[model samples]
Target: MPFRPDPSLPVPPAGADPLPLQGLTLLLVDDSRFTCDALRLILHRAGARLRRAESLEIARLHLNCYRPDLAIIDLGLPDGRGEDLIAELSQMGFAVLGISGDPAGRDPALDAGAAAFLEKPLGSVAGLVRLIRQLTTGIGPVAKGEEVPVPAGDPMALRDDLARAARLILAPGDPAYARGFVQSLARASGDASLEAAVRDSGTPFDRARVARMIEDRLNRLRALA
Candidate 1:
């Protein structure tokens, strides 16, 4: 008779198999540590390995040595616009996906040769899993009927988001450089008041408004902390 199975080995939970992304690897490019944390958990559950880079410069460094199967880039990186990086990655043959809170940024991301665009606050784990499968493997999403976990909203992360935006606001020159990042930061952090405050921060003569916004938001963030 054939060798029988071992009776005491461990087993994965139900619906854990059929992982469509079994051999795929992904890179997440975003400045928000919290956003990365959330996405990391989602991708892991989907059976895909994740690599992270917080800025364009760092992402370039990662690209020099390792190539992921897919790259999901956030438009608002600290060093540069992710659209610019997408062009280079597209040229290198990576299946690239772009994500942003600003609709305007989405078009530029696509123009730079991203495979597709995903709106921010990615929200649900099931939606993300399905999206990656559809974008990378051209296969229907697996585990459609299974339970999908939700990512937690981290207050500390939200505070960091405000801190980063405050730095950009205080620095002179053009706030436009960080406008997209700040807006996305507010949205993901669930701070609607701060979002409205940064609305015109990129325009000249709005320094007072921006400054006031930052101060107010900082107070709230500190309390949350």
Candidate 2:
């Protein structure tokens, strides 16, 4: 029997048929710990095994040892654009899926050879399961009657992302990269105020202001913790 995921189990118990993605293996390339945590929960519930890479360098290292059935890459990374890695993975015969907060990234990601593109705030577990099935087998989505459960948001993971973004903002290197990282995280986590702040923060003075905002956000996350 195929294995389906049971969210209550840390790892699903053996001997029962699970969801459609039971035997599938996936690689996720993203820098946000919160994003990773969210995807991990979703994939876990679908009985898919997932491995994560936080940067291009780490992803390359993972690729050296093994190739997964699908590679889900975030458009932005701490090291470089995920488009480059997606193109390379596609050339290597891997089914590549690109994800990003910006809808504008969809065409570029597809042009880079991704088999499909998913926009972020990846909250829908059932939608994800159906999409994986379609991408891998050319089969249509599962029946609409199935009850799909959404994963609960991890506040601690969100806090970690906020803290990391704050640190990057205050750091001395690549101001553009820092700003972009914050913007990406803000959009991915559905923080419109933060996203707007980071988007408008082009100058050094503006970035400083955004940095302060990030710090404040981080503090708020901590208070809730």
Candidate 3:
């Protein structure tokens, strides 16, 4: 389906082109529906088409069918690190943009050959558009003092992510993937307590505590629903 900008979301900078990315096709490799939902709005405003793959496996499957004009990869994935995919795609001459909720992910992503990197909770549509334009064309000049508006992800999507994490935390076996997933979500949502709980969780007791916290948040979100 074609992307359509949400009217309730922020508009681009006053002088910016409404359709700067027209005729462009983008592939987003990410797991979080929250992130995908937010990017959908941004891409729609910029007049771009989007296809999504939630993991490296899925992305490779997509690549086998067709190559997109650009690929925006999330540094963390459920199956593997996004940098590995970035290295392969960049070597293949694809324009790649790496994004992560963890600021520390920047260097590894860039070193892996991503054209550019953006920190997550990706607030600014104009900033993203500018970066995409520059990556594809090597030229995207922003007007002086223009205030690029920042759009937020859908709250329900966030709720869904938390709910999934809540389930993962309780599931038997190592919770490494869930921990990283929650860490990313915590950073994106500014949930410092949740972030700390997951980051410092090294023992069974700590893991149980983190599970409780996730469950509490999930319950609250369910209440709202």
Query: 5-124, model 1: which lDDT tens digit per residue?
Result: 232322334674545677787888888866766675566655677888888988888888888889999987767789899999899788999988776777899999998897766656
Q: Tell me how many residue pairs clash in candidate 3.
A: 0
Model 3: how far is 72 from its true place, Å? 0.8
TM-score of candidate 1 versus the correct structure, residues matched by position: 0.81
lDDT of 1 at 105: 74
What's each prediction's TM-score?
0.81, 0.87, 0.90
**Per-residue lDDT of candidate 2, residues 56-105 (tens digit):** 99999988888788899998888899999999999988999899877788
Alpha carbon deviation, residue 73, candidate 3 (Å) = 0.7
Which whole-number lDDT from 0 to 100 does residue 174 have in model 3?
A: 49
After the best TM-score superposition of candidate 1, give how far the Cα of residue 169 lies from its true spot, in angstroms: 0.8
Quick one: ranking by lDDT, best first? 3, 2, 1
Candidate topping lDDT = 3
User: Which portions of model 3 miss their true places by more than 4 Å?
Assistant: 1-11, 142-149
Q: Is candidate 2 or candidate 3 better by lDDT?
A: 3
- In terms of lDDT, the poorest run of 10 residues in model 2 is 9-18
lDDT by residue (119-142, candidate 3, tens digit) is: 877755667777887787777554
